[model samples]
Each structure stands twice: as structure tokens, then as C-alpha cells.
Target chain A: MALVFLVLFVAFLLVLLGRRKPALVVGLIGLLFAALMFRYHLTDQVRLSL
Target chain B: MQLLNAVAAMVLYSVVLGAFWFQFGDSELPCPLCLLIRIGMLATAFGLTLNAFWEPRPLHYGIALLGAVLGAAISLRQVALHVVPGTGSFGGAVFGFHLYTWALIVFSVMILAIGAVICFQRQFEAQQSPAPSLVRFAGRFVVILGLLLCLANVIAVTAECGVTGCPDNPTGYLIS
Candidate 1:
């Protein structure tokens, strides 16, 4: 999942260099990937801290 | 504004480099949460990259806002884990704060900064021209640099995690 973010971010840059719209698409993908990763981390690594 | 955006990107890249220094120099492999922080930070930086080179729009800054918010949440989670007595902490401390704590601070600043910047209506003027040559040059350099660093991160994570998920407490690269 983290790799997905990294790869999408790099793709964001790669597409970002030449175009804007596709780069935005890539950015959205990054956000989606981050969200999924965040969700997984929260649930899988759930720990009670006081 | 474009130049300033580029400078902001530079600051972010510097922080990532610092993380790299700790990962490679101090030989402390990043835990799972740590990698997420980097991902969030990079996503936020991506927004700045757009603002520096392309048209500065509310949408661009929105990306920064969302990234910061997400990053802040992750950082807070990490902080909570180590806040309790005897829970201990991950990695080493810099300037007396763990990296996750620093990440929280950085994300806080990014949220405020992005919120403040997005309010300037003049930046969204439809008649705006392309960025100056210097800004364009800087943008290209930053993007290229980011690509290289991100490639490095991909390789590093692969070596560290292998085919399985990353370990919670990583002391050495799994592939090694």
C-alpha cells in the first residue's frame, strides 16, 4: 500500500512535467492510495494509548 | 508567488532528505508509520509543485490542505502510541522530539500556510501569465529531484519489506 503511494507520487511527477490534467489525475490517485493506507494502518495497527 | 511556492517545495524536499539521512546514516530503518508520513508529505509537496509551475488554483491548494490533514492524523496516531508511560518510542529523536512529533508540527504548519495562501484572490486572476524563467527552472529541478528521490524510496522500501508487509519494528532490511 505504501508502495502504491510512492509509485503514484512518482507518476504524478512524471506526468506533471508534461501535462497538468493527467498530473491532477495522478494526484487524486495518490490521495486515494494514502487514504487506503491510512485506513489499513489504523485498523491493522490499532493500539490503545492513554 | 511562484518562486515562493518553489521555495516551499525545497523546504519539504530538505525534510525528506533529513529523513533519508537518519534512515541511511544512523541505520534506523523506517517503521510502517514512518513510511506513511513520508508518503503524506510527498503528496502535499506535489500540490506545491503544481502551484509553482502551473496555474495557481484553489484546487491545487486543496490538495495541500487534504495532504496535510491526512499527514497530521497519521503523525498524531504515532504520537499517541508513544505518549503513554512505558510504551517507548520509535527511531531516534532530533532536537528532543521524535520524527513523528516533528511530522505533526510540519503538517500543522502546512495546513495553516495552505489555508492562508488560498485566500489570496489575486493569485487566481484569470489573466495571470506563465511563471518566470527562474521559477520554471526551479520547478523542473524540483520535479526531477523528487522523481529521483521517490525512485530511491521505492527501492529502499522493497529491500526493507520484500514480498511481505513491512514489519512494525524494523531493525534491518528484510531482503538483507
Candidate 2:
């Protein structure tokens, strides 16, 4: 799951770089990855506690 | 823009060093894998500062490539430590992936992107010779100072880590 988000984030970065729209695209992709990772990590914690 | 980049690089390096100190003083001691990540961060910070100032494209590319290599190794080790517990030691298992992994990945990506930009910018600058002397001088100064700061932080962190023994918590709940 984390790997999936990592690949997507890297692809988005490559696209932004190719298109010369790095700032916006990179920022959005970074945020998306962070959100996904946060969700996954929190879920792990909740599961462990339960 | 160069100054901003240099400052950001410096701040990030300082934060990493501070984290190391906090870990030694408060939390559990860092394992070999954690130390590798710290080394990678230090290298990336150094490269970023150098890339910000150095107009020569090749030099920037070299620095960035070095940083990327270090980052890739550390990130891979970090992932492996989490996924394949037995591959590393108890210390490695204790110090699993955290926010530091994300920071390492971001640092690597930033280095690669900046390297590409430097290559493109170099070509543009070549067409317009006689670049501003002050800008070049300032960039050189920043690069030198940034390298020195990075070296100092790396030394401090390495010495501190060496002085402490790895702490273990069988329950894996304790902060230390």
C-alpha cells in the first residue's frame, strides 16, 4: 500500500518535471502521498491497540 | 533563490543533528541503520547547499548523484528493517521506519530535481557569457560555508552516537 503511493508520487514528480510545472504538481503529489501514509500508519496503530 | 535554498538546506541539516542529540539524551540509542540515515541526510544537505551556489553543472550533478546514492541505500535499508525484521539486528527492529524515511525520500527527490535544473540553467548561461561576478562569488561562499556546517554536524552526531550504547525495550513501547 505504501509502495503504491510511493510509485504514484514518483511518477507525478517525473511528469511535473517533464512539463515544467514542478511546483504545483509536486506539491499536490507530495500532499497526497503524505495523506495516504498518515492514514495507513494510523490504521496500523489502531489495529495494534485493538 | 540560491540564498533561500542554502538557508533551507542548513535548517534541515541542523534539525537532523538536533534530532540525533534528542535521541541520545532522551530516547533509545540509534542503531546502525539509523546512523546510515543520518549520514545520508547530512550528505544530501551538503549536496543541496553546494548545488544552490555552484554554477558549474557537472559539479552539481556529481554532488546530487552522491546524495541520491546515499539516500537510496538508507531508504532501502529502512524499508527492509520494517518488512524483513530478521534481516537486521534487534536494534534495527527497534528503530523502524518513521517520519525520517519520508524526509530522506524528499531530500533525494529534491536533489535530483535541482541537479536537472542546474544542467538546464548551465546551457542557458553558456549562451550568455560574462555572468554577474557578485552572484558567482556569493554562491561560492555559500557553498563553502554550507559544506563546513554539514561537516561539523556530521561529526557531532557521529561522536554522540558512538558514546552511547544501544538501548533495548522488550515491550517495544518505551520511547527509549
Candidate 3:
């Protein structure tokens, strides 16, 4: 999770540096990590009861 | 102008999330389809966040496209879940169909519309001169991110759904 934040921060910095393409690339990668985390949350547990 | 659209998207997504929370409270777990929508929402939020920081136009476009595609996919799934009883649990069946699903569909359309506007507006503005290098770079980045995120999300959902003997509880008990 922290790594995701770190990546986002770096991506933002890249954007600030006028590296818009890389920033977007890194942000998408970060989102992928987030999705994986969400998947882990969903599958690792046995059942989700409301 | 871009910020306005991004803010609007964020507002719409917040409503979607709020509706989901309201219908199911905090306890119920999301199904595979529902999880996909959540991923969509997160992507939109991330896009909005980047937009808020004035990252670049490409990032904005990417966010809008990602949100739109995810929204469309989930809405279609919700429609299927509504039409087909046991195809997949649509979560608590709030508002005739899953509220989040409906929200995702609506949000997706909005994002797509916003994306179209952004693209056309840029083209119109650039008629006389070349698009600024940074702006063009941003656009490419966004389009690529949108495509990749959508693909990754679909793969994740597919893998989860393919597993045998998945739990049947409507409100996902996994979170609890």
C-alpha cells in the first residue's frame, strides 16, 4: 500500500517535471497494483457477508 | 474546463459509492461483478486526483476512458444479473438492481461523454497550430492507461469468477 502511494507520488513528480507520459504510465501501474490488492481482498477471504 | 469535468466525474462517483454504502451498509461483501465496479470507482477517483493536481490532459483523458469502460462493463453485467436470476448475485438487489451497478453504468456514460468533449475540444483548439508537446503526451498516456487498466481489471474479475465452488453468500462474507 505504501509502495502504491510512493509510486503515485513519484508519478506526480514526473508530471510536474513535464514527464506526462511516464506519469500516466506509472499511475496506471499504480492502479493495477490497487486492483490486485482489491482482488486479494476478495479472494483471500472465505465469504463476504453483509 | 478540464477540472470542471473531472470534478463532475468525482461527484458522480461519490454518489455511486454512497449509494452502495447506503443500500448494503458496511457489512455486506461485494460479488465479483461488484468488485469490478469498485475497481472502476477507484480508477475514476485516481484520475480525478491526478486531474486535481493538474497532471496533464492525457491523464485526464485516460481517467475518463477508464471510468467509462469500467462503468459500461459493470452496467451491462448488472443488466444481465437482473435479467438472469442466478447468473451472478447482484448484491442485496437494492433499487430493483444493484445500486452500484446502475451507478457504474450511469457514471461510465458520463465519463465517455466527457472524454469525447475533451478530445474534440483539444482538436478544435489545435486547428491553427500544433498541439503542445506536453498536452499530446498527456493524451497518449491517458489512452494507454485506460486500455491497460480495463484489461487488467477484466482479467482479475475473470480469474476470480473461474474458481470452482466460490462462496454463495449474497453480501460477501469475506470482508467480515
Candidate 4:
């Protein structure tokens, strides 16, 4: 989850610096991270049963 | 202008850093929703950092607004979960406010501030020229710190959760 934010932050920085292509790539990666996190959270699969 | 934005970044980072300290100092592990809220705050700070670096466009504010709204939604959901009488919160309180409540306040303020900036565009417009070297230096410095903090968080979360992922009520690290 934190990695997702890191990638997203980097994408934002790239966009601000006018590096369009890289920003787009990083943004997509961040979205992917967010999606995975959302899926795991929703499914309740990540938490231990304990 | 750049100086102001850099200061904002510092303040924003400080808040997040404080949260991290509290989490570790109090020996509390964050749930998924808590992580999301932190991401939201980072996104808010990213928006402000953009303002310092580039021209003011609707896109920049849009990113911040989206993050803020998402974060607020998660915070609210958590509040709803615990709002029922006799429901216990996950962590200890800070100044009588839980972390999620503070998150709610921050997200709400960021939304309003971004909305206001969008409405009063001229007042917050960026300068035409490239930022001065000093301004650029300050901006980059703070951004670098943000990047480092994010990286640190990634490492810490990975260490805590491992491949299986964090338990809902994480008392200690799962792997070890």
C-alpha cells in the first residue's frame, strides 16, 4: 500500500517536471497497486484468521 | 511562492511523520484503511508540491481533490464502524482524537482548500518563469524527503505484513 503511494507520488513528480511518458507509466503502476490493495482488502483474504 | 509551498510540504510531512512515530511508539499496527488515509495525505501534499513546481492547472488540483475524497470516504467508513455505542477503536487516542478522526479533518480541509483554489484561480496562479534556483532547490529537497518517507513506509509495511499480508488485528509482526 505504501509502495502504491510511493509510485503515485513519483508519477505526480514526473508530471510536474513535464516528463509525460514516464508519468503515465508510473501512474498506471500506481493504479495497479491501488487495485490490488482494494481487492485484497475487500476479499478479506490478506488478514490472518488467528 | 516556492518557499511557501516548500514550507507546506514540510508541515505536511511532519504530520505524516508524527503519525508514523505514534504508530511505532505506541506499538500499533495500521489496518488497511489507515494506510489508505496516509496515502491520501501524501497525495494532498503531492498536489501542493506540484503547485510549487509547475503552472497551476486544474489537473493538479484534481489529483489532490480525488485523493482527499477517497481518503475521507475510508475514514468515514471506519467511523461508521465504530460509531455504535460501546464499539472500541483500534488504537489509542491522541489529544482525545483517534487517528481516523484526524484523518477526516485533514481530508475535509484539503478538499475545501483545493476547491477554493479551483474557484479562485487567479489568486493561486503560478508564475510564468521557471522557479528560481533557491526555490527549486527547496522544492526538490522536500520532495526528496517525501520520496524517502514513502520508501521507508513501503519497507516497514512489507516487513510487518510479509507475503501473507497484515492480520486485521496485528499484535506483532506475523513473519517473525
The order of the candidates by DockQ, greatest first, is 1, 4, 3, 2
Candidate 4 ranges with C-alpha deviation above 4 Å? A9-21, A28-32, A35-50, B1-5, B123-128
lDDT of 4 at B92: 72
- DockQ leader: 1
List runs of model 3 lying over 4 Å from the truth: A1-23, A30-50, B23-26, B85-89, B93-95, B120-176
Error (Å) of candidate 1 at residue B131 is: 2.6
Which of the numbered candidates is closest to the native, going by highest TM-score? 1
Candidate 4, residue B83: Cα displacement in angstroms equals 1.1
Off by over 4 Å in 2: A1-50, B4-8, B11-15, B84-97, B122-176
**Share of native interface contacts present in candidate 4:** 0.24
What are the candidates' interface root-mean-square deviations?
Answer: 2.1, 13.5, 11.2, 3.0
Model 1 TM-score on a 0 to 1 scale: 0.92
Candidate 3: tens digits of C-alpha lDDT, residues B23-101: 3475454454555455555556556545544433564667656755655655564565456556655456556656655
Candidate 2, residues B1-176, lDDT tens digits: the string is 45544555565566455555656565545544454455445444444544445434454345445655655655654564455456643331214535446556666676666665565554424434544666555555544544454344344433443333322222222222
User: Model 3 captures what fraction of native contacts?
Assistant: 0.02
Relative to the unseen true structure, what is the C-alpha lDDT of residue B5 in candidate 2, on a scale of 0 to 100? 49
- Model 2 residue pairs with clashes: B28-B176
Q: Per-prediction DockQ, in order?
A: 0.50, 0.02, 0.07, 0.28
- Runs with alpha carbons beyond 4 Å of true place in candidate 1: A44-50, B127-129
Candidate 2: docking tier: incorrect
